[model samples]
Target: MIMMDEIVLFNPGDSIGNFHDYHEAVQTAQIYQERHTESGHVVVVKSDNGAPSFDIFLAEQQLDNGQKNPSTSKRYTISKKL
Candidate 1:
């Protein structure tokens, strides 16, 4: 088992792209989120076989009246092919 750092960018519709560099992965995620006006995140996994890769979801911002609005957040993952 080889240990490595993997970066994953999650896009809308459950699409994902894997990156070897953390900076590139985060940059890509930010660009995509800004363009789509949605919430997304970049995750780093360190381990052998890269077990337990997942998405970081942010909840919708609350209104002034303390009401939770719907979030446009989406889930992303790293592809095994990477």
Candidate 2:
């Protein structure tokens, strides 16, 4: 039997953070996306031994000044993994 480890990497363009759990990393990424206008992403990698890992990419939209014209802020989840 073989065991595979899952690694989650949070990329906010300029910096990167690592997480052991997928949901926690995604949650943190969402928080960052809501707090800043800059675009950010999360990558999940699953691997075993020294073999190449499979990656899943998720990204958030970049908010602009014009999009904030409304009185209330909009909250939604926008992510795609491949």
How high is each candidate's TM-score? Answer: 0.34, 0.34
For residues 1-82, write the lDDT of model 1, one tens digit per residue.
9965343322233334445665565566566566756453333322123543333222222122322432432223332221
Global lDDT of each candidate:
0.37, 0.39
Q: Mind giving the per-residue lDDT tens digits that candidate 2 earns over 4-37?
A: 4422332233233344555665566556556653
Candidate 1, poorest ten consecutive residues by summed lDDT: 55-64
Off by over 4 Å in 1: 1-13, 39-82
Best by lDDT: 2
Q: Global CA lDDT of candidate 2, please?
A: 0.39
- Residue 64's lDDT within candidate 1 is 29
